[model samples]
Target: MTTAPAPPTLPRTTGAPVPVVPSRGAGPTRLRALDGLRLLAALMVAAYHYGGRDGEIGDAWGSSPAYQFPTASGFFAYGCLGVQIFFVISGFVICMSGWGRPLRAFFASRVSRLFPAYWAAVILVTVVFALPWVAYEAVSPTDALTNLTMLQMPLGVDRVLGVCWTLWAEMRFYALFALCVVLPGATRGRVALFCAGWTLAAVVAEAADNSVLDIVLMPEYAPFFIGGIGFYLIHRYGSRDTAGWAIVVVSWLLGQHYAVSRLWHPADLPDAFSYRPSLGIVAVITLGYLMIAAIALGKLRWANWRWLTVAGALTYPFYLIHEHLGWVAVHLLHQDLGLPAAATFPLVLVAMLALAWCLYRFVERPLTPRLKRAIMR
Candidate 1:
């Protein structure tokens, strides 16, 4: 659900870099590579969930994840950094799509794009868990309804899908950006100011112990999104924009600090691996930032393959259904069907991918246009 608020982006027009970014109602050239990168980020998160985790399975596995796949668990542990990657990409894509559009267009795109697939996934996962063969307890109807609104986090309701905390973060970012920046005009001057103000507020939000501020400001995640917007600015404005470079650098520094702090003192996730958290965290997040910067600078424009748009379309649905449903599938296959972890993992992943494609093709594709027209009207 953290995918951008735009349609499948158009192919990049071949030419030398245009020094001047079109400011009024003109979007930047479609970076097909961003689509592929988003799929990579989603897969990274999937790896962390499938391969990195342990002990929280509630007997979902015969053996713990670490014991089930000892060698691979070490590597997959670092995949938790994928959420940070998604936010950075979200920042860039949201900025690109939001530029020069009216508030209505922005609203329609986000609502239409996110809700259809999310609703489908919520129903699918909820029903799967409630099956007679599945051992998991289903959430109450009240919570299920709230989850549909995608505001379950702030309201203190549990998420139907565990991964949606990131969506809550994405929603807050969009809400603030729409109200504070896009609603007004989205000029270069205005966007820069929005970044500046958000950054400052985030810093303050970090220093305080206020839970409300933490949730609202998301000091932990603001930098990645801010950095993404900065990268978009660089893409739009050109290489000479000192302020754009500064935003990316500062956001990167803050992101490194926040990431290191969060990942270092982590406890409670049993057998989660001791993979040199500090060094590995820095390297992984640095990779995300560098990828965005490379795209903005047009260094990776050659990734315009036709298949990436399909990959990007599957990201949201795959992410939505992957967590609990995947756990159940693995348990069903490995424990009940007597499949090995090696086969079960790949099988479940493939099954989820197939389901994602089905939902994207049949569910989201059909619902998006009607949703857009209803809202746009």
Candidate 2:
């Protein structure tokens, strides 16, 4: 079964004010509350990583008697759902902003926003992790150059920074979005087109057992991006109808209970767990649709909600640095602190917040724009 796409939180205009930046800043951007959503999503991802990477939750969830239950497994294996939310939000915003900009301008802005911080993180990872283990296996100059250029994935190269995979994916998405902008008739359909086309592709992908499209030209995770696009379109043009909501809710329930589990795993399970036209997947997609609708149609003011937005603003850095370091920190502290994962989760969260903020204020913010200028020149 296909996974449900994420809900759109990007704005759809009803004569409301919104920030009009270049590509990827599209839809309604003044909705900083979505920033909060972004932050929340990133944090959830961080939590999942912290537990899983340290072999705490995965080991526990998979076998430990105390952590047998899904809920008790630690940050909810489902908490990784946050990544989908981020994708949905990114698609909506990027499509909206990039739609009107020239290709040169669009690419420049994206490169500017994305790369500097990434390079800095790479440098940090090398110094902290790579240098210490030089004799064990050092990063060759060629590998370093591959990573620096963000062509590591195509070359089948791994980075000193493990989290760089997502950046590679995001960069690919940007390239795809650029194609949409350049196509003569591409602007006409907007979200509906993206959602329908992605759904069809996803169905085909499932049949082919081909995951390559997603990593390349295709949206690696169509459900999330399509979900975001679907929500954005509905907010702009669809009615305040409850029909879509019904589909979304049902899909959400079904997906949680059956689809996500089965979709992610089938070989381990019997024929009973094999592919079926899951209403649960549809429900999940529909739910995302409703969320996007709520944000886009509701009002620009709606996006300005507090803490989540603050978190959203910090999400990128948090995501970039948190996993490896935070995972190590949480585990080393877990036994010593004698705290349950639940009790200790918030401390990890706070530490991530602090570190992310410091990275932004000190490393990313200062260097990103300057790097872009230098590169584009």
Candidate 3:
């Protein structure tokens, strides 16, 4: 009848771990795995340019037996795919960063994030690498001015650094995303619709052979970006939406088509290796899907390491500066100084990482906050 004595009341522990909740309209609090992924992608690109087809170091080493490391050589062949990974990551990160922010704040944040580090790389590469090592004539005053805007290609001006061509696509994506932000409601459904329309427009433009549309749609790369956005929608709203999956599937198909028509068609491949755009397309698609799957499965949710984020922060500067400078270093150390390719390659990589760290610490970190304040004000 006493109903087993009253259960003792337990005291609440104030020190219990608090769950980190995502802010309204923001992405998951952190994606630490993406940080490591960014570093890997950047390194892949560097290796590709250094040792892959028509690579600077590969060309300089001149069939030196020491330079023929199978892993490095084999990996370089697919290094260009790293840029595709970057575009997908950009789509996701940009959405995460801009979510719930006003147009002004988003624009300010983007400009702060991009311009300072970009400008530093441009100036440093122009003055140190291009002027002294590569083509002195190429580093004209107008080139410097054009490069500063990060719109050199669209403006019909040559890029200051060869690697900068990707920035144009990135900028275009930002412009298109900005358009979506300004639209009425600006809901996830509307964003998805916009991405689908953009993909369709890209396809139609390519089919019609419209030059203007080619510029506007950027048909070759839009699908990858669209796929990224599709993944974001799926992550945010869950997989119940069949439309999201459909969009991702359509984007993948169109992306492969574009890759075949645009990239592989014009590429000059080695005789032993026949042109196979499908390989690159499949690789990119696989990586993108894997990233989404990892997120959905909560596999990478625990990747909240601080060092990974630091590496991710260094990726942009490393990417911006590594290619040209690494080439220059190879020319100086391997060719001129008669150093072994084995030694010179690793040395150059280490030097590039050191320089990137400096740029991130001195230029990007310092300027970003100040620029954000100035622009947002």
Candidate 4:
């Protein structure tokens, strides 16, 4: 359930389309394809939350989600893998952005990217949950305010939207990267060691029973970020990095175990919905890896289209606004208004996408650069 900022797209040209590779001399060249890919990951997460489960999908929608989205539910069940994909993308983009920059600039970049839409989301969800008829749980005003800082999880305050847990994971990743890698200046050797050492440290933390380390390191999500960093090394420095490939392969192998382990221990589901292990889980995870590898190798250079930039712009806001507010809308249309569950699904999806676009266009686009300048100054 983690999310990340979209990578910037390469500028389009008037001449024949040439593949956009990383500059290798100055700053890293942005990949437009990855920007488009971020939107897909957000959509997958949204669909999974909306219609992926069985048994009333939260007891708020009045019917089984499997019954609601009969055909798509099975596929949506695997949508959690989208989080894995997001972390990988996060690794690549963060490394690309952080390379050769001081910690203040990196911190500013992350703050400007993450906080704008997240603040809006917390405010909006708090207002919505305050309405008496809503099905989602309402928390104390103090809890809601704490949620605004993205620190509610560690502070023992209830998350306004359960999906915000991923943001917490993402924030931790940024903190780790800042303090450990960027503090020393992110040279290639340092980053490679950080990726490997983080992997080994996760193991040590787990076996040694250190709760502080467990909380800080987030063992389950670290490998995707490691693999992503490795992928970025290949993209930035070319494929000659044996260390990069080793990091990717090691992370992929560990990623398999950590990812699939969740299948049997799914949180908050009813006892009736058994979590059976499946090869499909592994396949989807592998597919995510392969997709990142493709981008790292420049195989997706032709994907540099302009609209995908718009798609990237919409992704963070779309992800922020989708989950809890979406379910409320679902109840209104399907349960209150007597619409068919199947019919309601697309209607709600289209509505969420439109809402995301409005938020991005009206608020995020204009405000983000100013926020960045302020933070940088």
Candidate 5:
């Protein structure tokens, strides 16, 4: 899943009591709690991919007596929901950052924040895993070129890395949100209109059974993003707005429907596992909503430790490279060389974190400003 860069803090407002709705110039305040939450979500995804059933390690170990860990059964099973958490967080952060910005500024900010780290991860994964692994073929020159644009799937090319699919969803969300930025006035009203229009389009696409429209509209995932927008509205403006509350309620109901459908979809269920849609799925959806709710309520404001923010910064790069690289490490050490899972898992995590930090420090931090300057010029 994709993670956004930390949002720049909005300047503090003074005089009179804080308004019910943020003024156009009102900036977003730093929320430390959300940073901690982001790190937890990233780790959850990593744990899910590494230890859950159908995971690389799980498939390799396969009911062996030596492979059992307490965490392997319960929470980790639901870790895939971390991607949903990311979508909600993305919506909240994007709304916070782009609230009063011009369309060109919003676009420039997104490209600079996303592209530098994304390009680094794409290249690193291609070199480290894609080329060396016998199981996966090296990316073709055309695919490599397409991947660099980060629009490979939309452009009718395959993703060079499996996890990059989330980036496409993020790109779509950004495109949809840009419409509000370009509107003439009342940012919140414009956003509300966009959400209402998009949700209507999603309903129409579903009714028509149009796969192309469904893909373009991304009706399936719209709820999470809309839910994020709802949380932002509630945060910036009080819960008094009837229209905002209605949007939140409708988005949530739709999101739940989409979640249930995916959980029960034939393609998603494993043949050996007689999976039923159950409380586990509900819990995942509920937990994601609760996280955003907490942010809206200021419950997580105290979570802002410097170290937590540092960890949050690592999330994007760690998420980018973790799955395939971890799988490769497990294959070589745990399966081929017979290293114990206990040792191998930690080793792989440490290596992934080290690589992530290197990418962040060397590529993301250094290149982002230059790229932003170049783009904004």
Candidate 6:
């Protein structure tokens, strides 16, 4: 049977088919590629969790030759890079859709889209873990308040959903960046200066302590957010040529290894600082900025992958529920079936995708439009 046609995206103030972006000539009428890229990223993440050894498993054959291959895990380990991709996409979408609009409308739109389902996930997980006879952390009032507000990141608190720390960062960036854009005299120059200062401060703070505040606001990811904004400007007034994208993509990939090596293993630095702690992450994010630039400039075709789009659409929900239920599923399956890592990994991944697709179609997409209308009103 043929699947029903996907719902049309609601038009934003900028006339784009989505929110959070300001389009000059109606947004790219074609985004199948970006959608596909997102799908690909989500799948990689699933693979990483199920397959990666040494990280969350022991004596589980995760250390086997096949599993240890760099190519196998590196691509997925880089799945965290999907966060950067999301940020860039958000920046473009928001800038085009919400920039220059009334703060009330913009803020409302964001709240309506992000919170309903996300909070639902939080509540679901909390309840599941809190059930009598279940193994779970004792829920505290502070934890409740923090998680509810998604302030766990800036407040330097432990994440309730664990994987949600990244969402918290995204939320904070949206709020902070929007404020910066609309502030009295929040011109491009001022915004640039502020972002630069904030990034530098985060680096300094991370150097002092690896606290949540430092990590959440660190300079490492600043460029990703900024790159989003930069992309908007390019879309608005600059060229959207493929040549530019090629340059950025090539430069980012070729330079990424050196940057990672320098940041994480600081060859020239003295032994006391050999582990230079924060640089590798920074380099990775730097690469992310370049990737976004490449996408915007049309250099990255991976975003054009059809499967990537399908997977990308489910990413948020998949991320939300996967870790919690995934652990339980793995535990039970491993116990009963004694499946090896390879088999377990693929099986769980397929299950997660099936679950995410069902939820997205039945829950998220259905509610999003109505919520958007209510918020816009």
Candidates in order have lDDT scores of 0.79, 0.54, 0.69, 0.77, 0.69, 0.54
**Ten residues in a row with the worst lDDT in model 2?**
9-18
Tens digits of per-residue lDDT, candidate 5, 1-377, equal 12122334331110001112222233544565666666677778777777654634555544431245554544565677788878877777777767766676677777877788788877876787455443545677778878999889777786666777888898888887776544353366787887788889988888898988878788888888887778877766654656666777788788878877776444364543224355667777888888778777566665646676567677788888888777777677777888877787778888888888888788977887787789878
Number of the predicted model whose lDDT against the real structure is largest: 1
Instruction: Order candidates by lDDT, high to low.
Output: 1, 4, 5, 3, 6, 2
What is the model-wide C-alpha lDDT for candidate 5?
0.69
At residue 43, what lDDT does model 2 achieve?
64
Error of 5 at 290 (Å): 1.1
Instruction: For candidate 4, list the clashing residue pairs, or say none.
Output: none
Residue 146 deviation, candidate 5, in Å? 1.5
Model 3: per-residue lDDT, tens digit, 187-300? 677777788789878889988999888887888889878877776666555666566678778877777676556546434654433233557657765776687557633467
Q: List, residue by residue over 1-377, the lDDT tens digit for candidate 1.
A: 12123333211100001112332244644466777888888888888888886654536677667888889987777888889988888887787777777888788878888888899988988888788978888888889888999888888897789988988898889899989887997877898899999999999987887888888899999999999999988877777777889999999999999999887645455654545358788999999889888888768876767687677778888988888888898888988999988898889889988998998889987988798889989
Scanning candidate 1 in windows of ten residues, the lowest lDDT window is 10-19
- TM-score computed on alpha carbons, candidate 3: 0.84
- Write model 4 residue lDDT over 96-121, tens digit each, in one string: 77766678877776777677777887
**Model 2, which residues run further than 4 Å from truth?**
1-29, 52-71, 131-145, 182-186, 190-195, 205-214, 217-220, 237-289, 306-309, 335-343, 375-377
Predicted structure 1: lDDT: 0.79
Residue 272 in model 3: lDDT: 35
lDDT of 2 by residue, 265-375 (tens): 443456331222334344444454456556655544445545544465577777877765554455545555565666566787788678777777787667766865776
Which scores higher on TM-score, 1 or 3?
Answer: 1
Estimated TM-score per prediction? 0.90, 0.71, 0.84, 0.89, 0.85, 0.68
The positional error of residue 191 in candidate 5, measured at the CA in angstroms, is 1.9
CA shift of 131, model 6, Å = 5.3
